[model samples]
Target: MRSLVEAQISRIKRCIGERLLTQELASQEGEGVIIANLLNRWNAFGKPVCVKNA
Candidate 1:
């Protein structure tokens, strides 16, 4: 999943190479919003943690 997200970000970066795409960037702002909404419906995703305990 991490690789998939990285690939998506890389694709976007390539598409906007040497230029900033405000409109495109705005459009993608909602990319993960839907998933977050669905997760909220299911009461998923607890508070985020920066590091894992070993």
Candidate 2:
């Protein structure tokens, strides 16, 4: 479980970034939320789907 979590964090660091670009505390929190939403959408769209032939 720990390694899985670490892998997710590493992915976030690699995909989005290692540092928060915002200066203010609230903005930094918002930045993290935005990154998480982005990752969720990215994963959602990247999944493979099955199709049925009529």
Candidate 3:
């Protein structure tokens, strides 16, 4: 029973890791669209844009 519980936990961790990886990959691939959408939303909210020096 203990071993079975451990295996289920491991499977859940693996699934969560895979989902996070997919989200990261999708964000990287769609960065331009994401940035544009964010900017549009910011404008709609009347937020001031500030530049930060790296």
Candidate 4:
């Protein structure tokens, strides 16, 4: 579980980048929300769908 979380954080850093570009706590929080949403969208697209064939 811990590794999964760490991997996610690493992915975000790699895809978006590390460090907040905006100053102030409020903007930083907003940035976090935005990054989270982007990550969700990216993960949704990257997920593999398994189709069963008989």
lDDT of 2 by residue, 1-54 (tens): 999789878987898889999999999999989988998987787646889999
Model 1 C-alpha lDDT versus the unseen true structure: 0.56
lDDT of 2 at 37: 93
lDDT of 4 by residue, 1-54 (tens): 999889988977887899989999999999999988987788888757899998
> What residue runs in model 1 are displaced by over 4 Å at the alpha carbon?
18-54
> Model 3 over residues 1-54: C-alpha lDDT tens digits?
999768756754564342333347677567646545754664477535899999
Q: List the residue pairs that clash in candidate 3.
A: none
User: Could you estimate the TM-score for every candidate?
Assistant: 0.32, 0.56, 0.32, 0.61
TM-score of 3: 0.32
Which candidate number maximizes TM-score?
Answer: 4
For model 3, the superposed segments whose C-alpha errors exceed 4 Å read 1-29, 47-54
Q: Mark the 10 consecutive residues where model 3 has the least summed lDDT.
A: 14-23
The candidate scoring highest on lDDT is 4
- Which rank order by lDDT, best down to worst? 4, 2, 3, 1
Least well predicted 10-residue stretch by lDDT in candidate 4: 39-48
lDDT (Cα atoms) of all candidates against the true structure = 0.56, 0.86, 0.58, 0.88
**Candidate 2: C-alpha lDDT:** 0.86
